[model samples]
Target: MMSQKLAASCHCGSVKFTVELSEGGFDTIRRCNCSFCRMRGAVVVSAPLTGITVLEGQERLTEYRFNTQQAVHFFCSVCGIYTFHQRRSNPEQYGVNVACIEGISPFDFASVDVTDGVHHPSDGSSGGVVGRLLYRPVEKDK
Candidate 1:
């Protein structure tokens, strides 16, 4: 897919930004079973390190790291919402929170690949999908 730019922000709108998706665009979406990711629970799409530009509330952004501390997770301090993260698997790219993207929702995807972050590849293990998340929207009455 062609590269595309999308607006994104935290729940409180305190952190506004733009993300230029990688060549795969939304098709790069996936989830991780890591301790932090499992708790934050955000579906993510891919973007290069330079692809994201924070338009506002730069100071209100906070970062968190765990275990290997290779991946840096960013969130809106004002509303405490996960916005994106530097990928441990690929530091040159980021895994942007799909929910933070305008006009997009985590439920929009039918199925998402769940990577085995518990046994991270960086730790010398062959990381792979452990499961899949399925979204089934209910039918509405006419």
Candidate 2:
């Protein structure tokens, strides 16, 4: 597998950054039909919460939540760019919009697993999303 670190940023470029992607290969990413997700036209760059780090713009981010409110959407307040969202289904997972990534582009949605956020509420808790992701290998890379 090819290990690579991807750089991503907001539309205005005020929020500059980088992400160390999983080398095993990352998913093609998915587009949601949910109310909020659909409108934003965002794609998810997932990794465990611990794996993701905001390289900059810590103060420029604005968070928004509604309804079950487990999902927290992070946006660049200055540019009004919805860069990523904390999945309600899995609080431990982050769904960063692939479109915002500076270096890479996700072109295949058919290959990615589609997560139905709209109907997740029926799943009881987590609305079907995983709670606090824990993704790592048993062995360390040396």
Candidate 3:
């Protein structure tokens, strides 16, 4: 598995950036069933802050913070597309929107595991972050 540089942008193209994908590709993508994430509905892949480079449109990006305000969500003000966010769990990394990455689709994933954001470790809620795994069936040869 070789790491690849991926291009990402907002729906209106007001925001553009590049991210270095992990060698395993979308295998690292995950979803969160937390109040905010459940509504945002974007599958995310992790990348080190150093791996993400905002190429343009930084001024057009809006930031939203809530709860502990540790997690910072970035969205395109013009297109209202969620591009990525600074992970609350790991401040040194980011969760990039899988759908925003060019040449990639969320459907490319066979399944995605949902993190138990409701039971976050920071709050000491327990039960672990691996909440539920959603499966997508592919056609099987007869």
lDDT of each: 0.93, 0.67, 0.86
Comparing 2 with 3 on TM-score, the higher-scoring candidate is 3
Clashing pairs in 2: 89-129, 89-130, 90-129, 90-130, 92-132, 92-133
Tens-place lDDT digits, model 2, residues 77-123: 89999877777766876777787877555553334444566767536
Which ranges of candidate 3 are over 4 A from the true structure?
Answer: 22-24, 127-142
Ranked by TM-score, the better of candidates 1 and 3 is 1
Each prediction's Cα RMSD? 1.4, 10.3, 2.9
Minimal lDDT window, size 10, model 3: 126-135
TM-score of 2: 0.73
* Model 3, span 70-130: residue lDDT tens: 9999999999999999988879888999999998888877778888898887787773557
The TM-scores, one per candidate, come to 0.95, 0.73, 0.88
- lDDT for each residue of candidate 1 in 1-114, tens digit (9 for 90 to 100): 437679999999999999999888988999999888889898999999889999999999999998888899999999999999999999999999999999999999999999
- Alpha carbon RMSD to native, model 1: 1.4
Per-candidate clashes, comma-separated: 0, 6, 0
Worst 10 residues of 1 by lDDT: 1-10
